[model samples]
Target: MHKTRIGRDGPNVSVLALGGASLGGVYQDVSQGEADAVVQAALDAGINLIDVAPYYGLTRAETALGAALKGVPRSDFVLMTKVGRYGDKTWNFSREATLRSLDESRARLGVDYIDVLQCHDIEHGDRRQLIEEALPTLRDLKGQGAIGRIGITGYDLSVLEDVATTEQVDTVMAYCTYSLQDRRLAGVAQRLGRSGVAVFNASPLGMGLLTSKGPPDWHPGHPSVWAAAAEAARRCEALGVDLSFVALQFALQTAAANGIVSTVVGMSKPSNLDRNIEALTTPIDPAVLTAVEAALAPVRDKGWDVLPGGGGKAGK
Candidate 1:
């Protein structure tokens, strides 16, 4: 596991972070034992950042991660979680809700202070509220030692850029925008990095679209995007390789090259840990990568539609 400075002057952290959504069984039902193993595996592999949110399993992930990290030294890892987006259609970025949410997250994670407290899925909340109410409250929390850094997370590249530049967040997390099928995050990440905002590139598999099993029924990708990914997957299968491995490799390699801070991935079971580690260590075959990219060319950078600043329309 390689380590890098988070931002222009932030703390050093692993390039790969463990995403906690799966620990709460967001993708599949996982027992406490399995969740613990996944956390332990990430730590043992030197993956120092663990990202979670109350919305993940409706707070189950924070609780499970707390239990899994009970005996470990708090200094050994960086805890990152989010607030404001609680459900598919629920979002509250008011100052009062922000304060209460942080308290609940702290209690659930069994931590006195978080390393990085983010506004989760900010594009789903009112931009004005996030700026006028939530961000100021977070800054106050940072001043009071409730958190070390402030961050914003979302799927929209433009939203991330808009808030990160106009507001004061130390980090920005963009999902599904840096994978093989979508490279839209590259420009935004570089701009943010130059402006001293660390970028966390997440969902290397595009929320299961690049996996061998394909996207879930709830995935909101357009039909053309689905067809393009399926064709890419078929190409990877023909070459006796898993599409997810290539996708992860692409994300990790590209992030390293593009000044992005870290690449995040989720693991529900311990077995998933080994596979992710393999992605970090293995060298991707260029020929396979080229073929996969070619197959995905039709839908490259075609992000799904979402309302600006999260009003009127809801997107997952």
Candidate 2:
């Protein structure tokens, strides 16, 4: 894996960071053994940056990672975790809650200071606290030596745009906004890059919407999206390839070309890790990618809200 710096002052991390939500099995049931194996595989493959959250299977992923990293030296990897979203559907972005959350994450991951501490899922909460309190709290922790850097993660582009320019944040985790179906992150990409904010993109496969299995029943993909995604998947199958491989190749290479710091992909099984590494090494067929993009035109930027009250359309 290639290396890149997170913001101007953050740690040097692998271009392909391992996302922890899949270890928690947000889309399906993930066995503990499977999670541990993938974590080990990522480390063996020279992956040093791992991103996790308390809400990922309600802390199950952190527990597994802690067990997986037991014998490894702490300085060997850059660990990052999130605060604000605590439960399956609960949030607490207050400073007090954030402090407690950071402590819990450290204990779970067996670390003294997280390399990157991010505010997770910021779209559902009050923007003022996130901007004024939560972000400053991460900075405070940095000052106190509890964290190395600070940032925010969310699916909403507008909320992300606000936090990207907060001046206190050092990184941003954007999902679904920079994928094959959406390039909305480009709207704020230049500004964030110029401001020295490292943007880590997740959901490069669009939460399985671009895969043959389609999205899980709980994913926010709309009905029209399902149709277009199915058409794209069919085209991939005809070309003797999986849509996910194409999706990952397109998204990660594009992000690298665009100068995004890293692309975070989750894998519950170790085999997926190998495939991802291979996808990065091999060149993608542009003809196939162009066909898939054309097939997805109907669903492009249909705009589904991740938060209640239909709030995901801003900054598009």
Candidate 3:
């Protein structure tokens, strides 16, 4: 597996990162043993970066991850997590809360320090306070050896840019806007990646909207969007390819072309992890790409509301 640097000079993270949402069982319940197997699969496959948050399974994900890493050398992997949110669905960016959250994360993960600590979902809070309090608090933690790299993750691109230009975060994570259907981040990702703030492009499946089976009930895509997606899947099926394969590949390839640092994906089962690795290892057929594009042309960029920094708001 290849690697990419976070921001200007942060630690080297694998090109493929394992997102912890599924480990937390966001879509479906995952057993501890199953989660452990998936993590092991990631390590065995040479994947080095693991991103998780308290928001994922409300701390269940971190617990599983920490357990999975119990026997592994700390230096062998890059662990990224977040602070600034409480388990009770409340926002707390105060310095005291920040410290407490970090401590909780450390305790849960059974780690001395987190490699990358970001303010998770900054867009949901008062942007001013998050920028003024949470972000700086992260820097202070970095100074105090509690965290390594500082980062910000959100669905608001403009707010991210606000943090990027004005603050000192080492990386920024944006989701769901750089996939095959939405190239909203195209122009700026290269520039940001060149400038040294690693642009982590995640959510390549757009929360399962791009898959052959379609999204969960809570998804906000218009019904026609699903129809269009189904048509795209049929087109891929005609060519003996899965639409999911095309979606993930297009997301990865798009990230590469835009100079984005990494593409993150999540899976609760080992089978899912193996499938993604195969997708990454295989070359995407240009013919399939063309057909998939044509089939999805009507609904490309159709699902979410775009934010300023190339982040996306789910269509409601």
Which number leads on TM-score? Answer: 1
For candidate 1, lDDT tens digit of each residue in 94-190?
9999999999998999899898999988887898899999999999999998899999998878788988998858999988888998888888888
Q: Estimate, for each residue in 1-316, the C-alpha lDDT of model 3 and write its tens digit.
A: 8887776667878888999988887779998999889999898888999999987888899998888888899988999998876553467777787888888889989999899898877777667778778878888878899888888887667777677767856788888767877666666577667667778888888777788887776665567776777888888888887888888887776577787888889878889888888778788889999988887788777645421222223211
Best by lDDT: 1
What is the C-alpha lDDT profile of model 2 across 85-164, one tens digit per residue? 87756777899999999889888888887998888878877778877788888888999998988878888877787867
Cα lDDT over the full model 1: 0.87
Q: What TM-score would every model get versus the actual structure? A: 0.96, 0.93, 0.92
Candidate 1 or 2, higher lDDT? 1
Global fold similarity of model 3 (TM-score): 0.92
* RMSD to the hidden true structure, all candidates: 2.5, 3.0, 3.0
**Candidate 2 similarity to native, TM-score:** 0.93
Clashes (backbone N, CA, C under 3 Å), per candidate, total: 0, 0, 5
Mind sharing the TM-score for model 1? Answer: 0.96
lDDT of each: 0.87, 0.82, 0.79
Return the candidate ranking by TM-score, descending.
Answer: 1, 2, 3
